[model samples]
Target chain A: MNGKYRFLLAALPLAVVIGLSGFFYDRLGKDPGELPSVLIGKPVPEFTLPGLEDGAPGLASADLRSGTVTIVNVFASWCAPCRIEHPMLTALAKVPKIRLVGIAYKDKIEATRAFLGELGNPYALIGADVTGRVAIDWGVYGVPETYLVSPGGEIVWKHVGPLDETVIRGELLPRAEKLLK
Target chain B: MKFLLRLSSPRRRPGPFAGRVPLSARDPGLRRDDARGWRALALATVLFLSAVPALAIGVDEPMADPAMEAKARDIARGLRCLVCQNQSIEDSNAPLAADLRHIVRERLAAGEDEAAIQKYLVDRYGEWVLMRPPFEPATYALWFGPAALLLTGVGVILWRRRHPATVPEAEALTAEERARLDRLLKDEDPA
Candidate 1:
């Protein structure tokens, strides 16, 4: 009995060390800022908001269900990262069969128009979410979040920050092409 | 040793005309003055620290009714600030948190109860918006895991105490070893 208890006591530290090491190992190579979206693989939440441009029809959830993959970008004129990613978004607009829609989050229409005028508008349709209500529906934490919605209206992928050239070329394009296939 | 040395040292006279005064008589006021200064400094430090959160983060304008304002504060405290993950909406100065606080106040003013307001937020941001997760199947482990671990630890300790380990039987000594042990014991015995 003494020997058995001693053996068990000896195994306890080894078990604890292994458990802690496994936990840390799992954390390694993972970005702490990359929070998993709870809405992944789920249908896009319903929302309808006014358009940013004059007389343009506002975007609705039904508009995204047009049997084509849509890239929905949530941005604001005041957000610095949105400005950085605007050019990349412009480049993305040139890609054939890619439907890019922009949601102007919590920004004035005039400011958004000015921002687009200076930066060059890449969005096919721009929706003004003045109250940020539409953004909340999409589970947007902050500005410059991008979502890839499937043709069937499911939110396929979500990127939290500014999309650089590398990310656009490496991740977005590949994922978009995969959805197209 | 340092205190003893100081105690043994002779006091220095203030002037040629004056006799040596005891250290306590001369320095008691100085010590009291130093202590008073420190106490004032500490009080100021505490006050500054306590005032920082209020000054740093400008909360939204309070409702006219004190009870309504308190309810808004309670609701805000329970909501998480998406921009600042660790801070509640009540504590965060982030623009998004400010917007959420405004929404909460608006909802409360509209006579919407706390549950309905929280549900509105949860429908948008999912349950992650709640600072305290609701009691649900998904969160059962998170809520009960620590207590379960504690109980398991106590049970293991109690079991170990109740079923104490017994020493293993020892091997019998050989005749030669027994004779040597007897001789050594006899040699050491004064009686």
Candidate 2:
């Protein structure tokens, strides 16, 4: 009985050390900022908001469900990172069969128009989310977040922060290509 | 000069040491200086105390109904500010947090119940937007992991204490082994 207890006591410390190491090992090399979205693989949240341009038709959830892969970019003119990713988005717009939709998060119509005017408009349809309620539905924590929706309008992938050439070439293009297939 | 000398001197005043001399008996100039210092401190303290309430009340203006305002505050306290991440919407000064607070107030005024308000936010921002995570299957380990570890540790300690180690018994020596031991003892004890 004592031998059994001794074995258990000896094993406990080793077990704890191994367990802690295993827990931390799983977290190693993982990006802390990359929080897995619960909305992934789910249909885009239903919302309808005015267009950035005056007199243009408002965007709706139905607009995204057009039976083609869509890239929804959430950006604000106030966000510095959005400006940084503008050129990349402009380049991505040139890709065939991939519809690029822009959601103007918490930005004014005038500012958004000026932003698009200065940077050159790359978005096919620009939705103005003036109150940011639509942004919350989309689970947007920060501006300059991008999401790739499959033809069925399910959010397949979401990338937070500004897009760069490496990310564009490496992650965005490849995921869009796979979805297109 | 005599008053200045007394003021500058380290001479202990003779008495059952009153913690201080009467201001009137001391140098008038020094007394006036002390009064000015105290006034400045009091003014600063009043300004500081007044400023605190101003800042707190400035962000969250009271609603038309006090009950609705209180309910709004309660809901706002539970919502996390995505911009500041760590701070709750009620506590954060971020523009987003302020907007969320405004929404909460508007919802409360619009006759939405607490649960409905919370659900509205959760639907928009996911479960992470709540400062206190709800009790659900996904959060069971997060809520109970520490307690489980503590119980395991206690059980191990208690079991160990109940079964103390005992020294093992010596084996019975064979006749040849006993003879060898006797021979070694004799060799060591030789005069």
Tell me the DockQ of each model, to 2 decimals. 0.49, 0.54
**Candidate with the greatest DockQ versus the true structure:** 2
RMSD score of candidate 1 (Å): 7.0
Q: How many clashing residue pairs appear in each of the predictions shown?
A: 0, 0
State, as a TM-score between 0 and 1, how close model 2 is to the true structure.
0.77
List, residue by residue over A1-181, the lDDT tens digit for candidate 2.
Answer: 6579769979999999999999999999676655567788899999988987568977789988989899999999999999999999999999999999999998989999999989999998889999888887888888889999999899998888999998888898899999888
TM-score of each candidate's B chain against the true B chain: 0.69, 0.64
Q: Point out where model 1 deviates above 4 Å.
A: A2-25, A41-62, A108-119, A164-181, B1-57, B163-191
Model 1, residue A141: C-alpha shift (Å): 0.9
Cα deviation of B14 in candidate 2 (Å)?
15
Give residue B151's error in model 2 in angstroms: 3.7
**TM-scores, in order shown?**
0.73, 0.77
Backbone clash tally (model 2):
0
| lDDT of predicted model 2 | 0.84
- Look at candidate 2 and give me any clashing residue pairs: none
Interface RMSD of 1: 1.9
